[model samples]
Target: MMNLQKKKLYTLLALVALFVILFICNMLLSPYHMRIINLVGINIALVVSLNLTNGFCGVFSLGHAGFMAVGAYVAAILSLPLVKKAIILPELPKWLGSVELSFLPSLIIGGLVAAICALIIGYPVLRLRGHYLAVATLGFLVVIQVVITQLQDFTRGARGINGLTQYTNTWWVWIFTCITIYVVWRIINSAYGRGMMAIREDDLAAEAMGVNLTKYRLLAFCVGAFFAGIGGALWAHLITVVTPLSFSYDRTFSLVVMSVIGGMSSITGGVVGASLMTLVPELLRNLEVGITVGGISIPPLYGISQIVLSVVLIIVIIVRPKGIVGSREFSWNLFKKKKWNTMNQMEN
Candidate 1:
């Protein structure tokens, strides 16, 4: 116990150090590098929240983009200045025009709205398993996109909300990133997390053991959605825009890939995976454009990042299907066997 406590303390100190380092980077990095760092932080929040639902609860959801859309639009609308909102969304009710909020409250409202949506959908949606669940969630994403496109007054139709304030900074993003990590860590160390794991291992057995599948699944889904909402809000403010296309199928695919590449079963996996996926492709993005280095006039590589990432994904799938840190924590512990009492408790 003492050793475990020491480990915990050391981990906290290490995270603090990292936070400080990032804070320093925020101060010193060029705008482009700063943008990349901010994006990495946002991806970390998104991928980690995704890990909570798809990783821990054994739910293969693909509609996280829907939650993100809800969050981004909601936060954007709320945080936009009243005059701007009136211009962009001229069809909105007059009362809504009077209700502009600060950035933090907008983000909280966005997260809450997304969580409520998750709870409403998850109750019935979680009943499905495997690919069916994936399909249903994908359907949800499609629905959200359509709705956003149709709700011209609310979402500004296809053009999307634009020219907003840049409320998201390195500090706001990393703060939420830390919150996401802390919340996920607390959940992972809890009984619900154990039950969710049991469900992942074998839902039939978990059900037999009274693991209250619905409750735990919804818990994970809602929590995950909430943070995803927060991430979407951060993205919107950072980009200073929100649109139907902002949270698309492509976004969902990348996030899932991030979770799988990092380690579906580990919290640190989300961080590593998010960092790797975000940074590597961005670092390679310049290669896609033609550059006149030393007057050589090199042609554009065209999809260099995609090709490299595909190769990496192929390697990961072939060599480590569970991911680089599969079934392990930051300590790099070797794979360990599990006992079955994890999900034996369930309230009927």
Candidate 2:
């Protein structure tokens, strides 16, 4: 119990320190670079949220993008200027057209909308196990895509919705990222989180031990959807546009890749993986090879960074299936304790 308390305190302190550093960086960095960092932060939120269902609860949900779309559209609509929305979405309900909100409130409302949708969807889909669940969720994604496509008045259909104010910044992104990481870390260390882990480890055993399988699973699913929705809102605001295709299978695959490469069980791993993967392609795109080495000029493949990253991910999975950080979390004690003990010894 003492050790657990100590570990918890250490974790809290570490989180605080990390947030402070990220906040400072956000303030100091240029908008362009900050945008990249913000992308990493948002991806961390998305990946970690997905891990609740995929890693802790042992559910395979390929339809997180659906929740994202719901959030994006909801938040976008709420944040848009009344006059501009009137011009773009002329047929919108008067109530919706009259309402406007700041970024944070819109994000929360978006999350709530996504959570409600998840609750409704999870009722039937969560009953299926393994591959059936995967397929069912994939179908849900398709259904969402179709709905977005058909919602011509609200979503702008295939033409997509644009002219959104770019309100998201590195500060907002990192603040939310820290909140997400801390919230998830707290949950995973709590009894509810333990129950989810138990279900993941052995569903039958967890059921036998009096864990409400359906309730916990649905809770995890809802929480995951809520955060995914938040991420979507941030993304929509950052790009100043909302498109149905942005939340399609390709986007889902990228989120899945971050979770997998980071090691599903490791929150730190997820954040690190998301950051690395988000930046790598951009870095590759900017690389200029003007000189030839050994008479071989390095041609830029443009799209080859993704392929290289994918191959590297495959090799890592084969070699260290547990991911880069495995289940290890950041520990201030590990670094601070030794120095403290040495100081004591020297004084003695």
Candidate 3:
């Protein structure tokens, strides 16, 4: 027990030190690069949330972008200054235009609204299984985009909401990313998580074993939506814009790709997947600008990022469909196990 406690303490200290180093780097890095760090954190939150539903519960939900849209709009509206709101949303209601909120409160409100939406949507949609659920959830995404386009007074129609404050710095994003990871990790290790896995294995058998399928499934969906909403709010604040197009099917597909590449069953995979996917596009940006080597100029390649990512994804699917991490977790307990074995051998 003492050794375990010591190990935990050391692990916590190491994590704090790592964060401190990263924070220093963030402060010193160029703004363009700093943005990438912020993006990495946001993507981690989004991927982990989606993993909770599709990965753990086997729900195949594809409407995460819709939930994110809800949070982004709500949080952006709440945080916008009264003057900016008046300027941007001239047709908005007087009450909405006049109100303003700080970042944390507005973000919470956005997440809560998304969770409520999931609760309502999940009741009916969760009844379906397999591809049917995927189609129903996808329909939700389409509905959200249409509503945003039509709600001119609230959303400024297709123009989108802009000039949002940059409240999503590395510190804020990193804090929330840690919180998201911790919460999801706790949920995955709990008895409820086991029940979710059981359902994924065989819903009928799980039901026979007295696992309330609806209750557990709804819980996973709502929790996933809640985090996805927060991620959306962070993204809006980070980029200072929220358009209906930003939350389209393509955005959801990107997230699904990240989760798939990371291995949905592993939380570490979410982090790993989000990091690699986010960086790959930026790293490939140079390919778009052409390169010169040994007095030879290579012409710029258009849309090379997409092609490269697609090829990489196809290869992964063909070679290792389970993803980079699959369902396994990385552990530091190897040292502990070795020590215990040595003690037992000595005693014997």
> Which numbered prediction scores highest in TM-score against the true structure?
3
TM-score of each: 0.91, 0.89, 0.93
In angstroms, the error of model 1 at 15 is 2.7
Q: How high is the lDDT of residue 177 in model 3? A: 92
What is candidate 3's lDDT per residue for 1-348, written digit by digit as tens?
Answer: 236566677769967996998778877899999899889999999998899899989999999999999999999999999889888998888787888999999999999999999999999999999999999999999998999999999999799999999998888898899899879877877878888989999999999999999999999999999998999999999999999998999889999999999888778778888999999999998889999999999899989988998999999878879778787654444455543221111110
Candidate 2: tens digits of C-alpha lDDT, residues 1-348? 126577667767876887787788777888787788789889999998998788778888998889999999999999998888999888888898888899999999999999998999999999888889989988999999999999998898977789999988877787788788878877887878889989988999999999999999999899999999989999999999998898999888888888887877767778877887798877865544333679987775666666777788889889878777666654444465542221111110
- Looking at model 2, the pairs that clash are none
Output the worst ten-in-a-row residue range by lDDT, candidate 1: 339-348
For candidate 1, give the lDDT of residue 213. Answer: 89
10 residues in a row with least lDDT, candidate 3: 339-348
Two-way lDDT contest, 1 vs 2, winner: 1
Off by over 4 Å in 1: 1-5, 290-299, 332-348
lDDT of 2: 0.83
Q: lDDT for every model?
A: 0.87, 0.83, 0.88
Angstrom error at residue 289, model 3: 1.0
